[model samples]
Target chain A: MDIKLQKVTKIFQAKDKSETVAVNALDVVIPSGKLIGLLGPSGCGKSTTLYMIAGLLEPNEGRIFFGDEDVTDLPPEERGIGLVFQNYALYPHMTVRQNIMFPLENIKVPKQEALSRAQEMADLVGIGELMDRKPKQLSGGQQQRVAIARALVKQPRVLLLDEPLSNLDARLRLQTREEIKRIQRETGITTVFVTHDQEEAMSISDQIVLMDFGVKQQVGEPQFVYDKPINLFVAKFLGTPPINLFAGEIVKNKLLLADGKKYRTETQAPEHQEDLTEDAIRAMTHEVKVPICNVEIMDKKAPDGDVVIGIRPEGFVVDEKGPLELEIFMVETIGRDTSLVVKDPFDDNKSYRIIIDSSYRVKAGDKVKFSFKPDKMFVFDKTSGDVL
Target chain B: MLEKQSNVKAWLYLAPAMLLLSVFTFYPLFNAFFLAFLRDYEFLLGSARGFTFLGNFINVINKPDFGIAMKNTAVITFVSVPIAVIVALMISVALNSIKKFQGFLQTVFFLPYVTNAIAIGMAFAFIFHSDYGLLNTMLGWVGIDPINWINLRQAGNADTSWIRAMFALLVYTIWGGLAFKIMVFLSGLQSIDKQYYDAARIDATPKRRVFSKITVPLLSPMIAYITITSFIGAFKAYRTIIGMFGESLRPPGALSKDSLITIVGLVYDSLAHADATGAISEAAAASIILFLIILAFTLIQMQVSKRRVHF
Candidate 1:
């Protein structure tokens, strides 16, 4: 089912007559049969949004629709949603088979049919051999599979998972997530998965909704949001070895990097840097006396003012003749790539990172010159964090 | 050597609790078990004639008062404990469902637990007092004649008086002891994760079905605990009746020791008449019998719980 929340808000009233707005005027449409990820930090209202959709919590302000049918006033049972909690929440007293069959029994399915359907769900989750075991006797991963089978046995229209993989060990987290994706596909149930792990969300979700402090920050394909974030928060939140930020400004038609060097915006076409001459590239290896050029185009949309520069670690190329220089402080090699932790040459108070192919023989104490890919760089207005 | 030293340190740390338990709990238990087999107990000399295997048990078993006490105790246990458990469980479920003034309701229900049992029994006796009592007065308002609740001697026959006294005692016992059971069940119900109920609600399970299938089974451990303790507690019912009626037991002119005497009351009566030849022996035997009955019920409950309890 396609779930829609229109101007929804939830407020929690505390004992002292104070009120907290947990979710504020949130609106989103989750299309049917697609796995959407609600990604955020701990207090970001992602789980709150999922619970509202499940009808566990009634919105204080607006209506909720499940495939064009208003279900705001309905209870959870009438909404036909299946929710798996962070702890799995299996009935400890019931065996795997009984736990899976409980919902069927609730709806008064015949005894024999309920048993067979429960067995079928167990087999689907690959726990057919462990149906007789209670939840306490099973490993964390097995327990998770039982929880999933229990939620899916009734074939709910929308499946909700709240940090389902948070309780598993590292290896099991990976394995169970893959299993969840497969099960969701096989069942073709619309799923809303809430998690704080960006990698987990990015790996499994068809669409990722990033939120912070009860507000939706960005929503798009995981890679698209990563590559082109709407704001500085989105840019900083979605990547590993997170995008490096620096205080920057535009003055006299020159982009002034935090490191004091100034580059004329019209010196070279940013699109043609890959084909630069070898000597030109090698010339970038020289000292502070030589200045670098043709790095990237300053976003024309940005008003002339103070801005924040965002450079992904991968955007930096180790060209000896490139425009920017840094004093390498440390080198870390991890198989395919090497990380160069360097002192910012122009700004004494800051440091930057450049991840180069492991084949590069850079060492600490070496002064390296570099430049960024034009496509990989972003500029945000200092006050508003809007990408320019 | 380190393990030996640590073991010695552990024992040294445990010395006070062990001393207290041995002096207060274990010694009395063993002494009672030994005294239960004595033939003639002389309280003046603080000695017994000889160890007579099951002699005291046989003597106490043959006494008419002992029989009446055993029957009365059984009646109270079998009647009041179940009523208390069912009523308290229902109250706990109702209290747990409402959020407004929940703390106030809990405090009101739990007031009886901390209040003196004897005080509450005295208050209950006034309410059930027969003439001008609150209960009889309210019934009189509805055109019903005042009923004799306590001291039912005016009812005329032995069987009718016994039945009336039993009914009056049961009402007080069930009412006086409900608070503790309600508190236990309420805490048990609260400890259960709200997620399961949320899951049950999503499954569209009916309220009665949820109670039977989820709440009951999930709370079976607490239920078993409450059952065994309530039965044992009811078996030891001495104070409530003493508070309601009196130590003399029968009213101004009673015929025999037939009114409302519990096992503990019988034991107390025997100990009070300690100058009699076999009085101490009979008291010890009665104590032993009460212990055995409680043990038997506890064991039966544990067996049932092992089969049905979830955790």
Candidate 2:
């Protein structure tokens, strides 16, 4: 079922009577039968949001709905949600079969039927033959599957996973995450996955909700949000080796990079240009001394002031005649892609990571000219961290 | 080579404790076993009139009060242990769940453990003292006549008086037993992972089902431990009774014999009259019987609780 949160907020009162907001007035529609990832750094309220959805936590204000039903006051047992905690939370004393059948015992399902349903869930999670084994007797990955099987045995409408694979080793984490995805797909449960790992969220989720502090930042398809970030924070959070940032300015109608004591105009748009065609900007510019990105990607009428420029590591292409020049601080080559640790001469000698093809034979201290891929570059208002 | 060196060093570290145990604990234990078989033994005179298997046991068991002591000990053990275990389990569970005043309440329940058992028994004796006692005064307020709880020793209403005396002893013993059992149970409850309850709650389990299926099973090991220990403790109860009924080991006034005397009481009474032929041997024999009884019951308890315990 589609889960809906309308201005849900949760505030925790510590022992000393100090109140801290864990989740703010957040709004999101988790589409039915699709996996949604609540992605953020630690203490960013993603897990809090999942817990509220699972009915394990009550929002101090606002309502939660499962499909059409307002379940704000309902207890967790009535919510029909399968929540798997980060630790797996398997009953240590019970065998896999007993743990799975335990939930059915609450609803008074016939003993024979409960046992069969438990077996079915165990089979679905691929722990069928291991039902007789206790939780500790199984490996971490197997135990994780058992937790999932037990959660599924109740046939809950929504599946909530709180960093479910964090307990497993690296290899097992990969394998178990695939198992979770497969199980969720086969069952078609509306699963809400919470994780601090951006790659883990982006790799599996149909839609990813990025959050910071207690507020929602952006929510979209993983790649769409990565490629077309709405703001500076989104641009930096959703990349590996992180997005490269440099301080620059938009002087008059021209976006210029501070090249030491001179303003090197990358591209120029008409004062009120709505559609900034790259050809039009190039035609109006003086003789092209260096290769640079088209300024058309910037929002129209972007105010002329200091701005933060964010570029993905993959956004750079080494060209001898490129507009931006940087000294290579270090060269780190790992087979397919070589990451050049470069120092931007324009932005206070800040270090930046730009992934280039390993085929380049550049070494440290060599100055390399680089050009930007238009879509991969973003301009943001410096103080407010908003996209310009 | 490294392991051998560590092994010798470990033995050296354990030497003082081992020496103490051999002198005080192990020597007495073996000596008792040897004396129980002797026809007549006297530790003071260092004499034994040769060995005769079961002679001392048979002579001791033939005494009329020996059966009574056995009956009294059995009554106390069987009645007090299960009641104390259940009550302490409930109290500890309550103590574990409450958010506020937990430490204060735990200290209150645990007060009896720190106080000497005999002191608590004396206090209970005064409460059950028939006239001008706290119990009788409360009973008076409830429109009941003062009952002879521990004062029937000088009287002739034998069966009723004995039952009342037994009741008083059970009450005193149960109160003294609560503190340790509650402390053990409270610690056990604390160590249990709380997530299990959360899982049960999400399953929409009823409170009763949660207690029976989740809470109790998880506490089964502790319950078993408390059960076996309380049983042994209740079996070896003598000092508390002395505090209540005094050196006579009976109720007040009309005592023709030491009523409510436990097996340990019988053993001590026999040892006091060590001048009698075979009396010291019989005391050793009585203790051996008590040991056998405890061992047998413990083994049975271990077997019964074995299947249920999670660990």
Candidate 3:
């Protein structure tokens, strides 16, 4: 089933009569049979969005639909959704087989048939031999598999997983995530996975929806969203060692770095430029106040205004005679790549990091002149955090 | 060599508790067993009489009220304890589900547990009175005749009427037993993860099925605990019965033998009535028998729990 949300909102009321908007007017379209990741940090409403889709939580406003069927008021079971909780909530008293067969019990399936189906599910999850073992007797990963088998035995139209790999050890998390992806593919259920781990989401999900503070930030193909983020938050959230941020401004159609140097310019539209209007762009650009930290001036000429520069770690190209100069503060060789921890020579506390080839023998105090790939640079209106 | 020294240190730490148990518990327990095998109480007077083996046991068994007391105790324990556990389980499950005023309701349910059992038993006695009691009045509202309860004790009545008096006692016993068990089961239910019920709800399991399959099995350990404790408690029922029925069966103004009695009551009666030479032996034998019965029941329950308890 294709899951669609039309301005769904959920407000949680507190004991003192205050209210928290857990999911604020969220809207998304989860294509049928595709694993869509709801990625965000803690308290970002990703889990709330997933739960609303699963019908475990009702939206305070707006409508939810599964393939054009209005299901805003439907309960979880009636919505044909299988949800695996964060802790993999298996019934501790039951054997693996019994846990898998639990959903079948109330449906009047023949006892033998239900048992056989449960066995099949266990085998599918590769725990067939452990059918008689209680949940407490199983290892964490094994118990996780049992929980998945139990959720899937009913053949739900949509599968909702709320941080399913959060409870596993690092090695098991990777293995079980692959297992989950494989199972979802075999079943071809419309799956909505929620997690704070951007790497996991990018690796496993076909589509990733990044959210923050109860608002949707970006939604697109994982690589597409990563390569061309719509906002500052998306850029900051999607990378390992994180995208390096520095304060800068456009001046006289030239990019100005914080150390008082004006790099050459070539005017270019941001990746999300088509969706923005001239007035909206002006309003976004007019809001930023500049020159807060070290700035890498892109070749792209933007209107003269305060902006935030986001550069992916790999965006740096080390050159002995490049235009921009950065004094190397430290060198960290992390197996595959060496990270050049550089700081503004004028302001020592304003440090900027860039990754280069580990084979490059760079040392601290070396002043390296560098230039950036124009496409790798993300220009954002500082105040509104919108890509410029 | 160091492990041996640590072991001795651990034993030293345990010395006070072990000594206390040996003096107060183990000594009395072994003495009871030895006394059960003897019929002479001359030791109480600094005189010696050899063991009479089964004589004391036979003497106590032959007393006419012995059979009545045993029957009464068996009936009350078997009937009231199970009913108490079931009622408490249901109430606790219901209490566990609701959030509105849950603490208030729990406090209300737990009130009787903290209150004196004898006081509640007396209140229940008034409620179950024959002519003008609260129970008969309620039954009378439904057109049932008022019962002969306390009157049956003062003046011997037909066998059927005596059963009514016993029924009155059962009602009080079960009511008094409910509060503590309910508190225990409620806490157990509260400690269970809410996620399991959410999972069951998504599975669309029916209410009754959820209760039997999820709630009951998950609660098996607590259930076993409540059941064994309740059975043993019922077996040792003393103050509640005495409070519900007056001191000597008949009230202060009446003229008859006590109609309602239990094993403890019979043991007390024998201790009070026995000639000086035999009193201690007879009382010890009766108590030893009661202890053995309780131990046997507890062992049987433990065996059942081994197979069924989930945790």
Candidate 4:
């Protein structure tokens, strides 16, 4: 089923009499027959948004539509939505067969038909042999499969999963994630999946809506969103080990580091040239030529502004002659890649992380020179945190 | 050396409790069984009296009131237990659906279970009185004449009979008996994972189907527990009845005594007037019979319930 949320907001009355906006003015369109992921940090509104769509929660101000019908005020049952909780929420007292058949029996399907359908769902989820066993009698993965089968038996128009694989072990998470993707593809049902894990969301979703602090940061296809994040939060949140940022100032129409390094901008100069007269521009330009000046204009080759520059861990390259010197503080070798925690002599409050091939011999207290590709450098406005 | 010391320490830790159990529980149990064959003074004075095999047992079986008391106990157990279990289950299901003030309602239902039985019996006596009672007053408003209820023996002599009205007192007893059972079933209902209901709703399952297919089957274990406990409790339903009808209704008498006399009341009558030795022995025999009946019912219920329990 297609889902549409218009001006959705959720405000929770906290214990201390404060209102916490869990979702704020969110508008989203989820097309039918596709898997969509709501991804964000722990306190973000991803799960809240999914719950609103599932009819498990009512948005404070919004209208929800499933297909052509407005179902905002409908109960969960009336909405015809299947929801799987994070804990799997299987009834421990019922056998797997009974659990799967519960929805059919509730709908008053004939006993024989309910049995056959239950068996079909069981086999589909690959837990047919365990049908007679209760939830506790099965492994976590098997119980998860039974929960999925129970949700599917109703043949609901929309399926909602809230961090369905978060309870599983690492290996099982990957396996189950793959199974979820395959099942979603096979069934071709509209599904909204919620998770704080970006990789899990990116791997399975046709479209990913990334959120932060109850606000929609960005929404796009997984690859497009990853490659071209619209803002600093999106850029930093989507990557592992996060992106590194540096403070630079605008000087002489060029970017300047605090440590007397100058960088040039490839983009057009600011349109506020009228604010800076010709004489002021000339004076600013002449200051770059003076070597003894205390002002450190960023290198003419770098992007220019008083901006925070974001560099991915993989963006840095090891160069013996590079100008940037980082004191390696720690190194974590993980077979294929090594994560290095290095101190930035230029900034006391922050550290820069760089990733290198694991084969490279690197250790703590070692000094390393690094350079990043020009295009890989992302500059953001310091105050707005918007990409500049 | 440390392992041996720990083992010794474990035994030392358990010694006090073990000693208490032996002194209070196990020793008394063995003494009761042994004394079952001896004269009363042998038990009281710890004398070495010769065993009178089946002597007391044979005398107890020959008592005329034994048959009537046994029948009364059976009737109470069979009728009261099933009714209490069914009523408790229904109340539990209703309480489960009430989202608001559920705890308050549960506490109200559970209050009677914790209240003293004598107090409930006193309260019930007033309400079930033949005249100037709440029930009779309500019946009067419905154009029914006031009739003798507690004094059913007198009622039978008059133009009207009130045996059925007297039996209505069982409903009060059942109400007080079912409070704890309802709490147990309520907990069982709450323990059910809500996902089952959600799944049922998605399938458009009707309310009745959901109750039968999911709620009833899932609550079988709790229902079984309630059944066994209620059955045991019903056989011991003497205090309330006596408190309501008073001692006159169960006068000191032989086996051809009043129809309302129960096994415990008979034992009380015999001990108060007849030979105390014979009365104690007869009480023991009656207790044994009651125990066996409860044990049989419990065993049967367990067998049937075990088949239905999902776990």
Candidate 5:
């Protein structure tokens, strides 16, 4: 059940007479026997892509293939794809056993065989004793397990789940996500799961495809995508308390702040700026160097133009005699680490966040200075929003 | 003082409906039962009415027409209610699957329930006419001769020639009664959660199995409701049948020497033509019997409903 989606796109005509591109030119190949997650923010088309893969929704363009068979035109039933809806759409009238057996019966499986398979699925999902209970009689988690069993009983070639654990409470969601991963591994079935929660996706998926605003932002292993995000959106979307971005320019090998403070960087500066006119180079230099500070400069170069620097909270280290100073506005102490909200010296209206050890004492109104590891700094072209 | 006032205000809120129910519903039911047990008495003659328990009841059982009328009512109710419910269920399922013009189709099916029964009866009479009837004309096109449908009022109509007209009248009555049942069934269908169907499809349950296992069971409450209502409606099939068949005949052995009659028809006849004391008493007894028969059917239906209802 190798699921492949080629150049898939979906445009929805909203009730307000506007067209929303739900999935734009998306392509992904999910290998059989792996649990893959499509993760993104709300309205990012992750669920739309999953629905298209399940054959529940028709994409405006592109094709889907399961194994060697092109099933883009097939209906959900004909595609032999098992789908678990977000709300766990279990038949309310049927008992757990009946719900699990329903699909087998539909495919005209022998009654005795269907019953045995249903019982086996029910046991696998851990609802064996609750076989006689109707859906409404079961708890939310129990009902969800029944729904999963019902989907799996048919032995579909591929399984599609649309935010299956989203309806559960926090503790249950965590428990169910683990159980789903275990089941996927045990069955060795190709599964596509959709969720807006990055943690859930990272925890369960063998590979993750992160999406934003109908476009594929990045796709890789959980750690790979998290550590080396393809763009700012992916970087910000994957982390808790997103990465911090600053307005700065690169001059020679030093990154210059908007207030003209020069910070040394190991990153090589682009070579084309060496040919700029004297005035242009001077203007760039002035923007990088602070007028108030006769600060010690380890390196200097003619600044070229403006660039935005991004830094994750974890990237900054608080130290005495650090280059950047800040006034602490709020402190959040969470057992493992403490997050500090400090005012930005470069912009009066803005505040930047920094994470420090939980043992460090920091309160509102405390003044602190921070220096970031030069190698960890990310400079982006401000106008283009591309990494520089 | 505040709590006392709150209690008083609660009672005030409930007072109107309570008063209305006592006056309109409870009072009449007890009064009907009490009237059924009363012996011969005359208010105009200033004579005291005395209690005679089971006296009128026994008299009703003795009348030969009583058995026949009871059998006729049972036949009509049994034949019409289940058929109406089955037809309504089919129509409702069809309406549910129709994506386009669904509202229009629903309105068409529902129109009969709201339309005047007299009008429906008249229209059906024309369609079922022995000579220029639409049904007979269609049958003729298919190489079948005209059927005197209104004259075949028995199960063995081919042999029981005497019951042909009555049976036709029964069919006409059933047709006139179908609109309301269909509307009820449609509403019931709409109320079912669509998730069940989706789950069934995912499970690979065939369409027919889904309908039987999920749709039918979930729809039991609606089926029960329609069954009771249709049965009651069938029992009250006088206006439609009489309107179609014309109103001149009376029962075969009426004391007033009439030809065609029903229990209610006998009551009307007794009140209008025969002013005899015994005749009036007998009519009252027949009314009581009709009431009891409907009551017994309803009670049995409710017991069955309680067992089968899903929610």
Candidate 6:
């Protein structure tokens, strides 16, 4: 079922009577019959949003609808949602079969039918052989399956998982995440899972909702969100090696990069030098020079100011006659891609990385000239950090 | 070689405890077993006429007070242990589930445990007093005639006195022991993973079933522990009755060994008459019997716990 949250807000009162807004006023529409991932770092309110949807937490200021039915005042038991906790939360005293059958027993489903349905769910989760084993006797992956079977046996409309794969070993985490995806497809339930692992969300979710400080940053298909980020935070958050940022600016109508001492300028305009307060020059450090025509600014009208440039590690292209030049200090192989750890010509303190084809004969101590792919680079306003 | 040296070091660390136990616990216990078999033993003279096969045991067993003590101990252990345990479990679970004033309520319930049991028992005596006490005055308010709870001999016949005194003793015993059991069960309840309850809530499990199927089973280990220890504690029910009925340990005006004389009380009585022939030996015999009874009960509890407790 599609779930809708409108202007939902949650506040927690601390022991000293101070109030902290855990989930600020937010609106989101989760489409039906697809797996959506809520992705964020710790304390980002993703889990809080999930609990509010499950009715375990009451939104301090708004309404929730499961499809067209308002369920804001309903208790968790009334909402047709199956929630799996991070620890798997299986009843340790019960065997796998009993754990899977507990929900049915509560709803007063017939004993024989409950038994068959539990067995079917266990089989669906590839744990049919572990029915009689207690949760403690099984491995974490097996216990997770039992918890899922227990959740699905009652046939809830929505399945919510909170970092379900976090407790598993790396190899098991990969295997079980795939297993979860397969089960979601087989059941076709509208699922929402919370995770801080960007790769996990990108690999499995049909749509990813990225959040920060209890506010939604962006929401779209994972690949779309990755290729076209809305801000610097989204760009930096979604990549593994992280997007490289440089203190650069736009001059006239072309892009100028901070390449070295040759480009260092008295950035504060002489006319504005008397007003160079800390707030005005807050993160502005200018070493901009060498305009090139190949790069494109996101918003033409917003160009011509000290700005930041975000370049994906793969955006660099080696050319003998390009504008950007850097001295490579190290070259390391990452499967088919080679990482060139080059010294940032503009800032000696930063270790700049450029990923290139491993087949290229790039070595340490090579001075390389590079050009940018306009689409792979982003220009963000220096003060507000928004894409320009 | 290093392991051997560590073993010696471990023994050195244990030496003081061993010496203390030998003086205060082990030696007395051994002497009790030694005295129980000797016939015609005298405490003051430190002499025995001769050793006889189960002579002291036969003498203690043949006493009129012995059978009464055994019956009284059985009644207190069986009646009070289950009531105390179940009541304590309910109180602890209720205490745990409330959000507000939980710490204050826990401190209130735990007050009796820290207070001396004898002091609490004396307080209970006043509460259950027949006249000019809080209980009888409350009964007067309820329009029910005040029942002579402690001094039962002033109110009824032999069987009636026995019944009334037993009722009073059971109440005092259950109340006196509840604080410790409740404290234990409360900590046990707190240690349970809250995720289990959340999962239960999501599953639409009714609160009653959640208590029976989840809370109770998860708490079985603590229940078993409390049951075993409480069984041992109830079997040693002496001071609670003394505090309620005073040092005489029976209803006022009742004949000797008639009502509320526990096994420990009977043992103390036998030990008091040390000038009499075979008195200390009989005391040793009575204690040995109480020890065997507690041992048998604890062994049975462990066996049951092995099969039932989840942990």
Which candidate leads the pack in TM-score?
6
lDDT of 6 by residue, A277-358 (tens): 7655655555444422233333344558877888999988887777778788999988788999987655568888899887
Across residues A1-388, which tens digit of lDDT does each residue of candidate 2 receive?
7998999999999999998898899999989999889999899899999988878889999899999999999999999988887888888878889899999989999999999999999899888999889998999999888888888888999898989878889998788778878888999999999998898899889999999988999999999999999899899999998998766677665566543424344544355445667777656655323323333223335778877788899999898867777788999988899999876544545678999988888999998888888888888888999888
In candidate 2, the residue pairs with backbone N, CA or C atoms under 3 Å apart (3 or more residues apart, or in different chains) clash, namely: B153-B254, B154-B252, B154-B253, B154-B254
Q: Score the docking of each candidate (DockQ).
A: 0.63, 0.52, 0.58, 0.35, 0.41, 0.82
Full ranking by lDDT: 6, 2, 1, 3, 4, 5
Name the lDDT of candidate 5.
0.75
* Candidate 4 reference-contact recovery: 0.64
Would you estimate the TM-scores of all the predictions? 0.91, 0.91, 0.91, 0.85, 0.85, 0.94
Model 2 preserves the real interface contacts to a fraction of 0.69
TM-score of chain B of 4: 0.84
How does the DockQ of candidate 3 come out? Answer: 0.58
- Candidate 4, superposed: residue stretches over 4 Å from native: A14-17, A257-306, A320-323, A333-335, A344-350, A357-363, B1-24, B39-53, B152-162, B248-258, B273-277
lDDT of 2 by residue, B1-311 (tens): 99999999999999999999999999989988988899877667878889999999999899888988998999999999999899999999999999899999999999998998778878998999877689999999999998888874335664335788889899889888899999998888898888788778888889998888888888888999999999998999899889988888888653545388899998999989998778888999999999999999999988988887887
Query: Between the candidate structures 1 and 6, which one is better when assessed by lDDT?
Result: 6
Candidate 2 chain B: minimum summed lDDT over ten consecutive residues — where? B152-161
Which regions of candidate 2 deviate over 4 angstroms?
Answer: A256-301, A343-350, B153-160, B254-258
- In model 3, how large is the Cα lDDT of residue A54? 79
Interface alpha-carbon RMSD, every candidate = 0.9, 1.1, 0.9, 2.6, 1.9, 0.5
Evaluated at residue A24, the lDDT of candidate 6 is: 85
> Candidate 6, what DockQ?
0.82
All candidates: CA RMSD (Å): 8.8, 8.7, 7.3, 8.1, 7.7, 4.0
- Pick out the ten consecutive residues of candidate 4 chain B with the lowest summed lDDT: B249-258
Q: How far is candidate 2 from the true structure (C-alpha RMSD, Å)?
A: 8.7
- Best model number under lDDT: 6
Clashing pairs in 6: A299-A388
